[model samples]
Target: MLDWLRFGLGTLLMLGGLFVLVTAVLGQFRFRSALNRIHAAALVDTLGILLMLGGLILLAGWSVVSLKLVLVIAFLWLTSPVSSHLLGKLAVTLTDHPEREMQVDDPSLTRDVKEGD
Candidate 1:
């Protein structure tokens, strides 16, 4: 029946999402630098949420809960990147030696900083 088919597909999606989420968490611990951790988390945040919620919506059918899930996914997709960018900027600004971690391919992009400026 249609119900059984929906259940199977929804479960598969949910499981896949759970796997991605767990991997991201482990990646955070595996990566040492702040920028690397942010990269790990931000990379999977949207994809994991989308997969899990998309599965839930499918199982819930055409209902109000499904609509809310869609909205939540949209909100997260918008915010996750902004937050990640801010965190990355903070890491770059605070680090005493940004050069070791970051590379600027263009010499024109940066200005020389005097020893006492």
Candidate 2:
């Protein structure tokens, strides 16, 4: 009975994580701006990954492998936000007039976009 419950719970968690990741992917494609895309990427890196790893840990039970999974999740929790912030900073630095850059079809920015600005 406990085994069945565990399996069901773990499966649900894994499925939820997959759903979150898919939503993140869709968000990335829907949002036209690079910064908006970063928001979607960050969701996958943090929440989606955490859910996936949590499900794996539950499926593995209280073993060394589970401990390692916990460690990995902890590491990701610690690093993901910092990495996202750095990437956002880099995007801001590299792009000129980011808000204006959001409008891809703007004729005035056509040359700038072609130049990879």
Candidate 3:
């Protein structure tokens, strides 16, 4: 009975992750702005990987494999947001008008972005 419950929970988590990833992919195409696309990519990197890995960990049942999965999740959690922020910054930097892609609260950034910095 416990085994069945574990399997079911794992499957559900994996499915939810897959669904999040698929929607993010769709959002990438739907959004015209690079910043929007980056947001979608971030969602895939974070929530999608997290859910799928969590399910894998549950399925692995506290083994060495599960520990490795947890490590992978931790590594990704540390790296994904930084990468996403960099990508968004690059998008804003490269665009002719960063204000169009995203709001520049800092006057310094607004000036730099307008100048294509």
Candidate 4:
């Protein structure tokens, strides 16, 4: 009974993660801007990955592998946003009229940051 429960919950979590990842990919194609696509991709980087790793950890149970999965989740949680921020900044730096899309107070601010002054 307990094993069945674990399998069921793990399967559901994995499927949910796959669904989120697929949706994010579809959203990237559906959205028509770099920032919009990046925003969609970030969903996969965070929630989708978490769900998948959580499912694996559940299946692995109390073990070294599960501990590693937990560590991966923590690392991803720590890094995903920073990477997303850098990507967004890159988009803002490269794209024309990015302030309209990103709601930046001034696009020139991105330039000033890049020039190191």
* Per-residue C-alpha lDDT of model 3 across residues 1-117, encoded as one tens digit per residue: 999999999999999999999989998899889888998789676999999999998898989999999999999999989989888778776677766666667868666655764
Writing each residue's lDDT as its tens digit, candidate 1 over 7-66 gives 999999999999999989998999888877888999998899999999999899989999
Distance (Å) between predicted and true CA of 27, model 3? 0.9
Question: What C-alpha lDDT do the candidate models reach, one value each?
Answer: 0.83, 0.82, 0.86, 0.85
The candidate, 2 or 3, that scores higher on TM-score is 3
Candidates in order, TM-scores: namely: 0.85, 0.81, 0.85, 0.83
lDDT of 2 at 49: 84
lDDT of 2 by residue, 1-117 (tens): 998899889989999999999998999899887777988888676888888999998899999999999999999999988898778767766776776856545655544553653
RMSD of 3: 2.4
Candidates sorted by TM-score, best first:
3, 1, 4, 2
At residue 54, candidate 3 shows an lDDT of 93
RMSD of 2: 6.4
The residue pairs in collision within model 3 are none
Model 1 lDDT, full chain set:
0.83
Q: Tens-digit lDDT track for model 4 on 1-117?
A: 999999899999999999999999899899988889988998676999999999999899889999999999999999988998888778766776665665667657866756652
